[model samples]
Target: MSSTIAPRVRTLLLLFLAVTGALLAGAAPVSAHAALTASDPRQGAVVDEAPAQVSLTFSEGVAVSDGAVRVLDPKGKRVDTGAPADQGANTYAVKLHAGLPDGTFTVTYQVVSADSHPVSGAFTFSIGAPSTTSVALSDQTAGGGVVGGLYGFARYVSYGGFILLVGGATFVLACWPRGAGARSVQRLVVSGWLALTGATLAMLLLRGSYTGSGRVGDIFDLALLSQVLQTKTGAALVSRLLLLAAAALFVAVLFGAYDRRVRADGTGEQNATGTGDTSAPGAGSTDGGTGTAAGTDSTAGTDSTNSTDSTESQEKSDLAFGLAIGGFVVAAGLAATWAMAEHASTGLQAGIAMPVDVLHLLAVAVWLGGLSTLLVALFRAPSLDAPVVRRFSRLAFGSVAVLVATGIYQSWRQLGSWSAFTETTYGQLLLVKIGLVVVLVGIAWMSRRWTARLVQAPERRAAEAVRTPVGAASARTRKGAKPKAGSGGGDGKRAAQLARQRAAVASAAEKRLRDADPLRTGLRRSVLAEAGVAVVLLAVTTALTSTEPGRTEQEARAATAAAVTPQTGALSLDIPFDTGGRDGKGVARVELDPARVGGNEMHVYVDRPNGKAFDVPEIKVAFTLEAKDIGPLPVVPDHIATGHWTADGVQIPMAGSWTIAVTVRTSDIDQVTVDKNAQIG
Candidate 1:
């Protein structure tokens, strides 16, 4: 009835968790997914000259994928000299050719995040001034939507199957009731192994396509597969495949030992049953005609055979026990592979995080996988033993405790702040996962309650055993009936009636215990419900694993702050204009320092429609505040450089959307105008 976990069990669980965590840390990647934090030649900046190199800094370490970074000129021509090289833990740099002229050049990048997810974005910067002809980012390098979805699905399958195979086998060997669920348990374990194998193979192919061109044909491309194998992700997957192969061998040994033990026990049971019949008190007397000497010799032979059978059964059981232990050791090492390759290994305080993550994964496998196996047992079992239910209750309690503790730490590490939990997509998804976990825990609680009831039901039946002494009394009455019948007819008739009644009562009780136990039925229902909820929990967990954590998003926003910070600058643009249907062209340049709600100077340069500098008869500029609906302030400019004009002491009130229009007249019959919009801050 005690709800508290025992100190000894708690201590042992903690030790196990700690040791597993350490082992997992050694193989973990020790990083989180990367997000771009800062970039050199900041986006939308008006630089005086092109820099020799462009650099990008991320929230975590990253690997450049194919076509990872490309710098394009205004005309959309590539200008980057080579691949971007990692300058530091989180910085990547790309060199640019000398004397590069740029007008709104775009830098598009695609990199594999530390956690192996693909991330991409584009930004623009200009030399001298911004340009209307900005370069566009290409979609050729982007993964196709359907292929990406398939890859994610494969990842989910791999995780689920891996947990089930490891956890189910471990639970069966270490915790399942003797001689129960032999075939079903083996099938569960084998199915898990097969599922994991299929998922891993599918993932390898899907990953190749996902990281490459995302074409369906790429899934079978040997060239792409060879290239993918060279990367860290591919290596981790390959390692998993090898580990799974070893696990298959271990599983076979374990199962073979189990089969030997079962067969030995079965033979022993048959021998014991045969011996019992021969040694029955009434049977030996009937066989006296065969001769007393012969009977004694037969008994001796049977005794010797029973002794040898007992010894063989013991040996088989011992062998099975040893094989189970070895299997568990191999599974632990295999689980460590996942911890090493996942986000847990790459995040903050990786040494500590990796171990905690491993423990977390271990807890998940134990709870979810065990529940799945238990559910199967419930459905297939005629009558689940109370002892088995009680044992599982304890195991589940310990596993959930570990899960809760590790989950809190991971949430803090990934979210950084409470506000992020509400503000970011990753945080929102995490909340969903947490909510699902809570539901699963509730279902688990119900299962535990049901188990407690089941254990109590047997105790209740023991009390009922005292109330149902008819069977025992009937045996005594039958033994005394012959003597009593000799003494009196009435006594013999009464004994007969009592014997019949006792037989009826005993038969009813046996039927209830063997075929209609209500507690077993209820326990089955509860376990089935818990298993169903666990499936949903796994789905949510998969989503959480795929999501980008809020911490990365926060870092990205901080890194890009400079790009949006307001600064005083002039708006300069070159507009090509033609008037009077002539091939003549003109350029307009506007200069406004402290381009805000204050006094400023405005300048413009113009040429006749022909590519010649010709003084215009008249030139005028107009300003409008579109958002405020209050502008059209016209200003006449005095000629400065023949075709060039200048205006000073121009006033701009209020900071908002503003438009500037320039009108020019080459002669009485030739005139043209152009307009441009700018944000005044």
Candidate 2:
């Protein structure tokens, strides 16, 4: 019972690994960052009056889909026109109703990036002045809650199913032990196929809902499903279902129908043997009277057994060859569908990228699928095959190597900089995946060592052969000891009894040999532990797929750094003064616009320390290019208000340092000039 149960557990594990590997293989490509770079009325800016329109600019080109952008007033009611228009290249704008009240408003947007990933964000701006009655908009989009989780889980299920369905069958036909086809093993393969099929269909509906309303109830929404069916993602899933159907035919021929044929032939051969045994005595007794009849009967039985064996072998070989060819083509098609719809196909050199991704996915499936099947075989079979284990070890090593190579290319493509490893969320997740993979490899090393030990100890099989249940041993002993009382006389019966005693002694010796081996027990434990860790590694891989790639985040940051990043904008300062005169202490404010080689405005305002306006007799402002031969350009300001004065058309001629001096003459005898340095870029 323990032996029977062990294989089932391992079979289930293999199925699990297959599903996980497949889902991870189809991970969506990470999208570049599409940050909001600029907006009309600017984020958090207070305008003197409400504008007729609101506009937003992103770091990258954005596609407007349903609910792409919304404008909400301070009352949280939407006010922008229903449709948004694209302005220039990356800007989207929507008109506001006439005469919008003076208050804060929020702009919320969700746009699809060039890589087909959604980027969402929101910001707030006010009219007249900053408002206290407005609600704070979130800096980032909200998560997709329970519906999103289900979608992810469904993806995991689909991937695992594909791996198990294809990889498991391939392993059994190509590398499994010749003596290792238990009912449980067959069931495991069938279960995987069914799981993949069901998961594929489930994903179709879930995808529609996820992309549309992102609500759990939308899973059954037909309108969304129809819309989704028109998308690339939907088409790929549909193709997967069709390929799975074709694969089912291959599985039926290879593992199901062929297996039944083989079993039927075996049963026929067994029946022939039983018939020959029952008629043997009668033939011997009548041999003298009918020698020809007995001879013909014996020859016919031999001929029948030989014929059955040869026919069954030939039929199995032919069917297996066909299954292999058909299965490979079908499996490749299934893998292609996933590759075409994922991130890899959308990126650079997609023609080559698609095949590489497919190969990477297939290799991963093979390794994980084989490991799962191998673990089951080890437990179910009495003795492990040295050659089989060695072959699987080599195969696993090759798969890991391929995974590493492909993974490197993918990493380089996504994370264009080393800084992304620690800076981006996607990069951090990748680092975690790498760590887990390393640990899994270490465990695999231990498993390889056990395989080596098993190879060296070929005598282990001889001992395990007799480690059958005690009841079976006792029954065999009884059957061997018993003799026919009325037939063949005492001499024949005595000879048989002596032979039985010898056989019993041999069984006891074999049992003792089995009991002497402790390494066999330890090896089983190690393999099981290794399998546990491999499962965890697969789980981490799934997580990696869901996360955004570091490369995209870095690209987005670079783009934002390019746009909306001013070369040189405005600079201002407020210099305080005291002239040792009554009511003379005041603040002088100085401003420089576009501190560059262009005409700029310089405004000066004077205020008393107690917040009242300070009236000065004269105000003068001047600028001198520092460390250069340029002299000070003085500007006599025209008073615009009681405390405010401005001098327009002030010029900064070159890109260099400059000094601005503001002089406030309250009285002719009490005058002070405040100097400040500025850089023109």
Candidate 3:
């Protein structure tokens, strides 16, 4: 591999990554259940009749599998209701076993939103007389729109950048093998380091977003940061991962420097124990040495004691090279894991408590990191010498062992029941990944067999060379070199045979050491290719870990839609929530029934003499969104949607408080209508 990679090959690697980025990048939000329109018995309105059952209705259908509604009396006594089920696609109902006992009742329920988030909200409605005591869900806008958007965008970019960096570098190292202008393979290592850094920053940003931290400006503001940090669900998971990453980085820096020193020594062996003397008996230490006996087995064996010292020096300079690769894989997996988790569950605990996920991550890192290290060695090894082969084989074996162990543990953890193997997505994908790993192991085994075979060949040849030629030539030459005086046949033939054997052994030894032989090069490339496949498999594993292990259930309940909006006396309020028609779109339409619920008297006010548009200079109107910081838009029209916003469409853009200021200030009375700003799709 070359130090400077070719532009085209680099471009292709980058292009592939860019595409993967697009796949994982944030798509538009999907529309989920809209905000609660109106709860029957209207908050606090006491009714004389005892209802048979309690029901809650929404703007859209509630997912029955993950949705539930509960009715509680003021004393916190639960009312008996047949399993709370979705009455209509949009209405959730639970038949109460007992009725009467008015005071105040609270309907608390949670729904598994289409976006995969478990969202819960409660509303209080009185059974008999309305209660004065009431409660509202507390909400705070964590940050400004610009800050939040940048935060999410930065996270995505970091993830893309990390995957691009590692996957790209590894691809170059394995597939392109010194493509075009790259004079050496070191460039891949450099690229890997840069990418790992990008991933670290990304993970950090991800933590910030999920935890709802606004900015560094809020770090010292413990009240704010703590709010984000103390959140049991996301906070623990994000914090632990951040700490782990920081620890990993610190280790990487230290080990990277150490790894360089090892490479710089020019020994060609990572753990070589040197004897120091050039003419020592240790020359064939591995018995057919590469690094152990510096010049014993490589093509450059006779160059000088530990001759490629400079080449080793270069390896030492490449710090964090392998770790960079590991970091990339780890980061990509974590991001995908968290993103999907956010989609599927509400609290972070559900996602974090999945021990299988943690094991899956560890397994991926070991496999990917080990494969990268092996690949670098594959290119650097000058020959298929036993010592070099053994070293790599040992390292490869360790990685394979860890991968197998972690994989098995993960499988057991995720698929607890035997039937789960074929029943769940987690099971099926795990099987596929496991099958691929088996194949990879088979290939590695074959390589190991070849290396071991090569190790025994030299001694076999040395013995044959000494004995076979002598017997053959003597059989032929005995007749030709026969002397009348019987010229010392035995001694002379023996001497000649010995000389030939010496020459044969020397030739075999010479062949063993050729630094640039085609056969050696081919073997090196082959091993490299094997390692490359190993790395790719690792990336795939990472992807798998990030995916959800199940398909959403299709069964839906009976649904009913109730259109409700705020009422300011009478007039009419109509809203067409436009979720830009595109991927990740989230559109909301709030239509107030009659555009008002009450407050309209039989008489007329100054806002409008008749039930017509009141001609006023400006119709000052203000309304509050149920939740602050609406968060990311869901796959469906959902309240916790990201990039949430609200705006005035018509005359309501101006800010102020006004009451029935009906005046013909505007030239046209029809132009006095107003619209509010809603969250962007």
Best model number under TM-score: 1
* Per-residue C-alpha lDDT of model 1 across residues 1-681, encoded as one tens digit per residue: 012223332342233323323322221121225555567786777899888988886656777854688888888888888788877536788888888875788888877776676667788888988886646555643443567656665666667677778777767665673523367667767777887788788878877778656678788888888977987788878888887898888778667756666676777877776565545433344456755666576678688878888887788678767766776666666566666766776656667877788788878888877877776566554445667767777888899999999999998887888988998777887888788888878877887787787777655563366345864674564466434224778776776787668756765565456445667668767776776566656665665666667766665554344224634677676666666645345666666665654457777776544556767677788888643244698988778787777878876544445788878675677889888887654
Worst 10 residues of 2 by lDDT: 24-33
Task: Show where candidate 2 strays beyond 4 Å.
Answer: 1-42, 45-63, 82-102, 112-118, 126-143, 177-180, 261-311, 381-384, 460-522, 561-565, 569-681
User: For model 1, what is the error of residue 104's alpha carbon versus the real structure, in angstroms, after optimal superposition?
Assistant: 2.4
Clashes of each: 12, 8, 49
Q: After superposition on all CA atoms, what RMSD does each candidate show versus the true structure?
A: 20.1, 16.2, 22.9
Can you give the TM-score per candidate against the true fold?
0.67, 0.66, 0.39
Regions of candidate 3 where Cα sits further than 4 Å from its true position = 1-197, 203-227, 232-360, 380-389, 418-423, 453-536, 550-681
lDDT of 2 by residue, 1-681 (tens): 445567567665754655554545434323324566567766777898888998776644666755668888888888888677887536788888888888888888876654334566777889887665555664323224555556666777766767667667777667652422565556656777887788788888887655545578878988888876877778888999899888877776766677766676666676677576646555665456786788687879878887887788778778777877888788888888877876565544567767877877787777776776676666654344567777788878898999999888877766767998999877887898798889888888888887788778777456445544444654574566444456666768676686567667666665445445565555666767767776766776666656666755554454344333434667788888876676779998887776544467777888999878887998988878533335487889889998988888875543445687888788879888888786654
lDDT, candidate 2, at 113: 53
Clashes of 3: 49
Q: Candidate 1: give its CA RMSD in angstroms.
A: 20.1
Ranking by lDDT: 2, 1, 3
Candidate 1's C-alpha runs over 4 A off are: 1-32, 132-144, 177-181, 281-283, 289-306, 458-515, 566-681
